[model samples]
Target: MSDEEKTPEAPLAAEAKTDQVPSSPDSPVIASATTESERESLPDLPATESFSGSEPESEEADGAAILDETMSVRRLPRGLIAQILAPEDETPVWIDPKRLGRQSRRDFLLFGAATAVSAAGVWWLLPDGTKQQWLSPAAASRIDSIEARFGVTGQRRERFLGRVLTFDDDVAEALYSRNRRVRAYRPSDVTPLRNNYNGRTPTGGYLVSWKLTLSGLATGKETTLTAGDLSRFPVRDQVTRLCCVEGWSAVAFWSGIRFAELLRAYPPAPAARWAAIESAVNLDGAGQPDPYYVSIDLDTALHPQTLLATKQDNRPLSLAHGAPLRLVVPMKLGLKNIKAVTSIRYTADEPPDYWNERGYSKYDGL
Candidate 1:
């Protein structure tokens, strides 16, 4: 029984092996079963003609035409587009990334430079910032301490400033500075004192009896001149500015006689180096000869611009303006132009003046 079953199975296996045998190369089955490598080695099939019957113009032209027709443009997506559309009011039309980088860098540099310059300017203009250049904080503190301890008498500060002013004045005088002209204005431009006035009104009722005394002339004699006597001299007018140490200033038309004319009439002695003029009014109630006199250098007294004013703005002098007479010297500060004239004396020595003792500069030029 085992031999018969085995014989049947062997025959069936033999038939299966025969049926699996390869077909001939000439058969359709063998051609259909060809591998991709074998098919690739064979010649390619002819392409179908695109145009009906026309031949191409040239091989180069046909190749170019083919490339042109087949070329595909790859465009960026809508979301990837750069600056294009914009509102009309917008300043920048388009912002190029590369250009913006360069401009922003330049603008940053300019802004930084401007900020630095502004900071330096502010530092230079402020007193606290510039104080180091004038004096150290420690030195200034020491000066303040000395003033406080000395009870505000200004002795130390006055001495210090006096030395400073001496040096300053010496330099200024030696430099041959040109005299600054006072501004001129029409007589109508006289700004009335309205409300602002300086110093006190004249007391002792001397405005009525005030007379100008001229002494120590070339003749070594004394001469007293009244308002009528001064008016007899040649009358002149000058428009000059009166600048006060307190920082108020005004321009006025002053009608008067030039001191040069007066000096010519009553010449000064050759030995005289100074001219002292006294006022009839007392500034200090104590009457310590206070502001009673002001002395000018001989050169200043002889300056062409100096005046012995009898009138102001073409009108007779008012009581508040030293009624009878006032010395109007334009080249000097208003303080030096003694108001209420009582006496004029020439001396070889520097005459004592009211403010000079008060620690003010004698050469108070404009």
Candidate 2:
């Protein structure tokens, strides 16, 4: 397919406890990001492109904290739709005309019941105006009040409110993370894979000898294995939607060894709460040198749908589609589903994210 037609892929996140918002190595950011301009001066990436998360951007006046998320959850194209559908995450799982009427009565009823419970649960937690239509306007009104008192207007006002509001939305997503598993589909249902990226794929020559390295194990030991070793582990195949923050999604069949198998082989330290997946040198949408990475909660990484994806459809992945090895986690947004994974490190705190530093949500679970 042509570049314009193919789905665009984005950046990922990953850093050790020393930092949660990983800045671009060569960015001209001020050391003390205490000032709003200093914080906003980060990457300022687009929404669909993670590897670089480009949502809200905020930080404490002290600059001693994670940059506040101002554009993530609230800024996604499907954020409103996800809220409108009244379900957990931004996936409008019900909007697939292709899957309509494909389920038996039992499955359909179960899905409906689950969605209802999720809606009620969130409603009870967030109330009517917090995240719904009333949110932005209400926030605007409050910002107006602050402006009258402090003469704040234009971008400053937006930064303040954007940070506050997106933070609210991010909290809601992280809190319940409803245990609703996305529906799996048959191979026949697979659609053409869609991906867009500013970075070039790792050369096919390197992938021919690529191997996944596992470290930061709870055991405090590290090991490396070749593709042949991974093949020995039990494999999982599922067709699921890869949802993008820009609001497009596509169904694709992914085949790979379950992450659980790898965990069993290399258990994380009890203190390790996040898995910081690192990748080769790549470029961000801005064409900056982006050592693309992302750190996901161990819980999210261990979800059954998550995979150390080695194949898309029935064949080996093309370089354009993250050849050799990539992450395929259906529950998280596409950005979190990192491509071209080179190493996996377990960290005590959330690792710095490429996009989080660039002004997107730190926890962009779908």
Candidate 3:
């Protein structure tokens, strides 16, 4: 069985191997041969010039040219025929193994970089992606959306900013810093006061004629006192700056009795946490009687700098600058320094303020 049969395939196997290799490595390898005897003889052409003629122009080879050039191309098939057929720019040179390797590596790096950057941007834009100390991610995203034209509008902007303002107010109270006082400057540091009357400006000279009313005392009684009665308590003065909600400030010298001493003379009822102050009736620009009123927490009423001022820069109070008595609380913005000889009523709940009702902050603290 052995020797004859085994050797039978040997010669033909070697011949098949050699035949499978095309003349040009770049061209398609054609036709499989099951056995050497299956090979057919190609017919000799009618007659044609040998390709040994000047190699035809590398111009496009049509079907006729393909038959004529088949011999030449087989002799140098390394894409020569393809180059002739393909557009100059689309010539399949990029398919070369080494060049394709470099192009693929460069493309892979660029694609990876772009994908990573896009993913990070998407993460930051998501509402819950980041935890921040000041602005929440949701707020940040809304702000970004508004700026980036993602459909957020001015009304939405206003709503979020209102929330931001509320949060801003909360941050100050969170420190539990009621005891922290403002820096007091020297008398020489005092500057001229700026006129910032809201609804009405009083004409000068209510001094001596003015009286202060105190109500809702612990005894449930009300008392009235003149500016002179306030001098019975500690009369003190300090140079302090008055900051306004309108973003301006003035330093001034004010002399008055410490409001704490006044509270000692007439303590508020046990449940009272706020003191409401009202000015003598003053008319508005339209000539209507516009009331000026505000409230302060009892805690603020107790600060050392809280004063019932009867004088400024050594002169008696001018009615235009709140004659006879004006409450001076430097820890608050200029608005809290209620003007005019007025009444102070103690209450358990905050009283409605003139400006607060008109959109100013209730706690206007420094």
Q: How many Å off is the CA of 302 in candidate 2?
A: 1.4
| Pairs with steric clashes in candidate 1 | none
Q: Per-residue lDDT tens digits of candidate 1, residues 100-204? A: 565457558979999976754443333442445567877655644554564633354456667877787566456423354446667777765421334566554
Compared with the true structure, the alpha-carbon lDDT of candidate 3 equals: 0.67
Q: Give the Å error, residue 12, model 1.
A: 99
Which of the numbered candidates is closest to the native, going by highest lDDT? 3
- Which model, 1 or 3, shows the larger TM-score? 3
The residue-by-residue lDDT of candidate 3 on 320-353, one tens digit each, is 6787788898888889898884799999988888
Q: Give the winner by TM-score: 1 or 2.
A: 2
Clash tally, candidates in order: 0, 24, 0
Model 2 accuracy (lDDT, Cα): 0.66
Query: Which stretches of candidate 1 lie above 4 Å from their native place?
Result: 1-157, 172-181, 194-199, 283-291
Clash count for candidate 1 is: 0
Per-candidate alpha-carbon RMSD to the true structure: 31.9, 29.1, 23.5
Each candidate: what lDDT? 0.63, 0.66, 0.67
Measured against the true structure, the TM-scores of the candidates, in listed sequence, are 0.54, 0.55, 0.55
